[model samples]
Target: MAINIRNAVIQNVTGNSREELEDTIVDAVQSGEELMLPGLGVLFEIIWQNASENDKKEMLQRLAGGLAK
Candidate 1:
């Protein structure tokens, strides 16, 4: 069976308030489990898609800086 994980993750979080979403993200990160990475990737993908060019550049810069450290 082909399961669409990204869509599933999005659907699972659907209708969440800003605080709920923030709490979900914080919980996932704090869990430190490998399984959560895909969900986090889905979240990042959504953010990337909605971001403006300048926002994208800033995110890239921050990512690069983090990696350099």
Candidate 2:
């Protein structure tokens, strides 16, 4: 059977507060686990979908800057 990772990630955090979500993201990143990458990707996808064009451009710029470092 196949699993829908994006839906699963969303369901796991469905009712989280802003602080809780921040903690979750921070903890996932700090853990340095490969399994967490897909969840982060899902979160990024949600953010990208809802962000304004300017916000998207800023995000891309920050990403490019980080990659250059």
Best by TM-score: 2
Cα error of candidate 1 at position 51, Å = 0.2
**Candidate 1 Cα outliers beyond 4 Å, as residue runs:** none
For candidate 1, write residues 11-50 as lDDT tens digits. 9999999999999899999999999999999999999999
Q: Which candidate ranks first by lDDT, i.e. highest?
A: 2
Q: Rate the local accuracy (lDDT) of all candidates.
A: 0.97, 0.98
Judge candidate 2 at residue 47 and give its lDDT: 96
- Where in model 2 is the C-alpha error above 4 Å? none
TM-scores vs. true structure, each candidate: 0.92, 0.98
Tens-digit lDDT string for candidate 2 (1-69): 999999999999999999999999999999999999999999999999999999999999999999999
Clashing pairs in 2: none
Residue pairs with backbone atoms closer than 3 Å in model 1 (clashes): none
